[model samples]
Target chain A: MPRTVILGVIGSDAHVVGITILEQALEAAGFDVVNLGVQTSQPEFVAGAQDHGADAVLVSSLYGHAEQDTRGFHHRLTQAGLGDVTTYIGGNLAVGQDDFAETRETFREMGFDRVFDAETEPEEAIAALQQDLEIPLTETDAEEPARATL
Target chain B: MTRDKRLPESELQRIASDLRDDWPTAEAVEFTEAVEYHGTLPAEKRFAEVLETADRPLLQPRAGVPRLRDQIELLEGLRTEGGADLLPTTIDSYTRDNEYAKAQEGLEEARETGEDTLNGFPAVNHGVDGCRELIESVGAPVEVRHGTPDARLLAMITFAGGFQSFEGGPISYNIPYTKRRDLAQTIEQWQFVDRLAGLYTEFGVTINREPFGPLTGTLVPPCIAIAVMVVEGLLSATQGVKSLTLGYGQVGTLVQDVAALRALQSLGDEYLPDDVTVTTVFHEWMGGFPPDEARANGVIGLGGATAAIAKPDKVITKSPQEFRGVPTMEANAAGLRTTRQLIDMLLEQDVQIDGIDAEQEFIERSTRALLDTILERGEGDVARGTIRAFETGEFDVPFAPSESAAGQVLPARDDDGRVRILEFGDLALPDEIREIHRTKLDTRAETEGREPSFKMVADDVDAISEGRLIGRPDGSNPAPSGGDD
Candidate 1:
């Protein structure tokens, strides 16, 4: 069975296109994508992951409040029996844009398996997802290799 | 006479009562009395005075902290170092979202850390005296800037607390900052804010009301932004607001950005009420900035030059920390100093570009068509017309998340990096206007060797600071100054 991935723009943010593009790309790469659209809450994300049996929960936060919005998100997922799922986040993840290093570290310590920088190419995240999932490389995603793991 | 949207005397009294009851300290003073004390001040002290002067672009930096003393110090730092002609008190996100409790918490945290945990100052939670203290501490005209959709108490407190200027509008503020808000409701709420300004006007005080421009602050077509401004300006004027300042955000393409500012001021003078004071404000690049501080200064410098050439009444400065997070007071002043230097230097130079008239004319025609349709939709009642226009697809804003916005329009940049509508979507502009955008986009599509897609829009949105105006199909980017042709 194809690996299942759940994606959405987390928090009060409604920047939908970023997640929409990611959803389309994931589907084309043969991953089953359950897109929650924008303004998704932690409970909603957990529910989606549970309903879809998602192996990964990809969160896109462009408005810079994921720190507050996802403070205990990892713990909550663990509470809901999703602690083992791969977690990812990308896009203007902080309020202004300067604290990429700190933001990534904080999120990683918060239990995110991988944290994509705001400027990280969408494909880079995709390759990381494929590699982290230990999925065999499909011919379409073989041209570009994923960078070193975070 | 144009339909007066002013609240009746009884309703106005009731509104005031409820507002004051929310904050008893406000009830201790009179609104007119506050304006009387704050309004006579110079531009350095009274924001409306900034509009009264037209000799040079008044420079302002967005700086806010939770504590009154700290905020006062920050403003002083900006004034002493940045040489800011005007200063801002950007409200925290919690205050903006009407979460007063959260704002209070953030305030406590900020007080504890001596570092603001909140992104901005919480004027609402600080209440009347808090706002008054901040206003009194700063010699420069202090204004409130926030993305609040329902700013009822904020307006009452700030205006009564001695602020002579307020920013935001039903469409511009709501469509861009908020994800889910009813447009008609926000418009009506803003009418109250305007009516508050109107009341100040009745008392011989002129509070400068600026409609937030740069909806989405992305790749918005100038026509769409101008249409929203005209509608809001007309709506505010109908409520007896006499001092209105129009604003436009810089979009990186120098010619197009200058044309956007020029079109805004001209159309304001032409389309808005003759009785109102129509001035222009230029917002330095509201889009994404380079994380590199050096590159960001180049972006801010270009914005300053654009403002000087565009001849706006004032320019809002962006700091070097724009990309990372809330900037330090030092970064804010640094940006203002750089902007002042640029503006002063450009004032002596001609700074005029050839081939600008065509773009200016294009902006004018498009804005005219947008306003004409909106006015026709409401039979000349701007408030009613605005609601009707948004309900229909006639007044669409590109990439707006508001359920009230049609959000059908798609804008992209041409080979010359000027913003143009790739998909007009039911804009109701004349065929000729649509044809112009169609041709420009088609020409760009031919050069890019791909159909007009969202990829172009996404790339164009972040093209600035990457050293170019046009976001090419490929991920390859040029140096910061590579955009200079």
Candidate 2:
């Protein structure tokens, strides 16, 4: 069975464009995408992932409140019987001037398997997912290597 | 957490006084010019280029005709035979008698003439109506304000929070608050305003929809603030609101320069009503300058503190807890303490105002103090120190995360593929057109009050666009050139 990815905006933040773009990219990359539109909750994300038998749950937040907006999703996923699924988060996560390292750490502690900064390129995220899933990279993926390659 | 040692009382007092004095006068003068400049241009020209060049189709006509017809072979066969002449002589006579051509011509003429009407007015009206509809749909009240000073001040306050964001950007703070959760709270505050309006309407008060903000931040795009106001004036005629109060807070230094101020003043003379009173609120803390220089600029002194500067009647202060999305008990406590100190200073100034009392227990409870240690030290320190402070209970208030409160979470996937948010900045207009309108209106409004005829306003705006002005006088001279360009 093809691995499915559940993706969506998880709060009252209605920033739809970023999520829409990501969904398109993921689908083009051959991932069966379960896109929950804006204003989604943690439970909703978990439920969608479970229903779709998602291999991973990906989250995006542009509204700098991602820190407070998010919770222990890994634990929630485990409770929902999907602890094996990879969890990913990216965007302008915290509000104000905070260290990205500490922010990433905090999110990691709260159950995110991976955290990307606000400026993290989309290609880097895809690469990370491929690495974690042990999937072979495609030709289009080679065209834009990760930011670290540059 | 380290705190900066307090400056001497005398020095702080002097600085506070200076900031208070300088801030408002500068803001008032700058806003006055912004309103006046905006009013100088003919509304039609203000947005014509945008409409003509707009890539996205804002307007398109749809076809209404239907397809398909019933079979008329039997009737046609009868007509083709001997019955053909018996069908339509009476119908032809009736059709010939009708004067459809003349009526259609008259209607077309009216529409053509209406098409020449001011551009800014229609566009702004559309935008405002759209905004109002959005707000109302979400259960919020719409407040529309007219006149220069009021609009300018309002623009300043709305833009002040993001003053740093506008520098050198094509669009002034082009980013919409819809993306920022903290800024979104300010927008959401309109719901409270709507509730208030409803409460007042029950008392038979004619609740005027005063236009606040250039609120969406896009309220008036950068450089087109004046144009937005002019369009607003035209919109107000139908809206039935007479007076408008313009509020000015911390607008950027460059945008509010002398030239911009003059432009605002000219725009005001052309568009705003005579009775409209402009109020300027200069937050002393905005300008990072010595108190003495700031004082000369008419900044309202809220004691010696910047935060204490007088808040507007409808003040929207961000709760520290709300600022970063999570409630930081220490941050909230600090914010409240700062707010209280500022409020005390404002009360001492004896300024008359009514709204959220800074001293109220709820206000105090809701407000957090200035996390000076965190804010000054920067985000990394704040985030690190915040966690430490929360764990140790070193904060004045204990941390209690709201369980039921909806968290502002990010989506794992974005609809727009791009990680960043899209922004549409300021609207552009020909500089020559703006200048010409400014000169004509400024010359006229200084001498003539509200009595200037609409034709005169239009003529001045036209001449300004044309760069033709005769007898343009010295500074402070209110006379217009009598000669045609």
Candidate 3:
């Protein structure tokens, strides 16, 4: 079976458009996407992942509070016994001009497998996941994958 | 509880004293005097005066640097090279979110790099003196602009530092800029900010406070924007703000933009106390920018022309770098210059006003109705009424993250690109006005031969950059819909 990925804009961020765009890009690249939409809770992301046997949890925050919002994101995934799922965090991650290296390190320590920026092309995210998970690059899966609604 | 009253003199002093005690007051005083522009005018220069005196729309651009001295240089460049009528010190993200420790850290980094690492000025770290220095360095009256929900400390520092203008309100600042922040808590903190301005009013310093008018800056209907402005105006007036500038963001259509400005000014006059003076400020497009700099300039030029023909007292300019990142000083200055030159030329042309158009009446009627409902909901107090309205969806913002907001009000552009509320949620608009929106949007949908749905809304979200107003359902997908996110 192809891998399923759960994604959302974490807590109090209503930047729905960016998430919507990412969802389309991921689906076109042949991943079964379970989009939880905006203002999604950490538990919900975990629940969406567990319910769908998802391979990843991608959290997006654009309001510059991603540091605070995603502080316990990975911890919650592990706490919920979904520790093996590959995780990604992206967008305007921090408030000020903190070095991106520091930002990447901070999230890496928090257990995200890969961090994507708004500047990070969707193709890169897809390619990285494919290489990291050893998934087939071709769209060999059936076209009609079930979309899990939150 | 009563709706509005000035802070008691004793409370005001105690609050100011407590606020001062939280920071280094002695150093704060030095920063204020360092400002070369501090009290440079024969009379105290106030933000309201610039708007009131301008025969044509005055231009202001957002510019800030982490270091105080760098910010001073940036503003000077904007004034001399960019011809800014008014100056703004946009606060950094850390300060906006009240992470002063990080802001202080950025301040040091900026000093070392000689390049600001922070997005805006760190007013709190600069203290009263640092803020005053920036205010004085600018030739024109300056305003502190930030998207802060709890702006008390920042307000105290800047106002004492000699900034005579402030932007933001309890509802406007909280609902749009934050998520999960308690509505009542932010409102209470802002009451302190407003009361501080009132103390200045008693001291005879005519300070002006503006409520953010764009609210999420994404396809907000005219009535939704005006209703919030008027409510915030009334809230500030009760706190004894003698001068107020009610602001509105442009919605990319000409007549609708004009009508929104007129309605804001007229409504401010009507709702606020007779003694409180009111002016209108128009914002250029606050949403997404085209990736191309040339196309972005065209978008900005449209805003300038609209401001000119609409005859707003002042206009806020957005830089071409809006799509990429924080604007460079040169880009910021370019925005101001383009606006100033266009407004100057437009002042000569005649776009004579006749009787009230349906757009104006519709906006005015909807605003009045919403305001009345709020007053009724609050049972006379705007503060209480606003809380109740927000809780009940009587006042809701489009695309806002606040749980307090109903979020049911969906907005889509009509054929002409004027934002029309696709769903009113719980708004108390007159039936006739609602019909006007329905017909306008319905006609557009029919022309495109598509059902009015979220797709059109999505397309309209990207319409400006694509060089179209209405997101017509031409076969081309606006980035291909439906990942179902």
Q: Give the worst 10-residue stretch by lDDT in candidate 2 chain B.
A: B61-70
TM-score per model (chain B): 0.94, 0.24, 0.93
Candidate 2 deviant stretches above 4 angstroms: A1-40, A44-56, A60-69, A75-85, A90-106, A117-123, A133-150, B1-485
Candidate 3 per-residue lDDT, tens place, B326-378, comes to 78888988988888778888878988655337678878889888988888888
The CA lDDT at B125 in model 1 is 75
Q: Tell me the TM-score of each prediction against the true structure.
A: 0.84, 0.30, 0.82
Please give, for residues B1-485, the per-residue lDDT of candidate 1 as tens digits. 22327766677668778766654445555765676676555555767766567588889888777888988999989998889888899888887887777888899988888877888888877877788888888878888999889888888888878888899998888877766788777877787888889988888778889998877877778888888888889888977899888988888788998888888988998987788989888899888787688888889999988887887898999998887768998998999999999899898788789878888898998888888887787787777777787888888887666767766676789888888886666887889888887788778877987666555666776677575678887756666442211
DockQ for every model comes to 0.15, 0.03, 0.11
Q: Name the better of 2 and 3 by DockQ.
A: 3
The CAPRI category of model 1 is incorrect
lDDT of 2 by residue, A1-150 (tens): 346888887786656545645664565455688877667788999889888888888898887878777866677888999999998998888876799899899888888889988556455777777878777765234442221221
Worst 10 residues of 1 chain B by lDDT: B476-485
Locate the minimum summed-lDDT window of 10 residues in model 3 chain B.
B476-485
lDDT of 2 by residue, B261-354 (tens): 2333344344455643222112221212121222212222221133233333222122223322322333323333344445555535644333
If both were scored by DockQ, which would come out higher, candidate 1 or candidate 2? 1
Clashing residue pairs for model 1: A96-B323, A96-B325, A97-B323, A97-B324, A98-B324, B44-B140
Given candidate 2, what's the lDDT at residue B477?
37
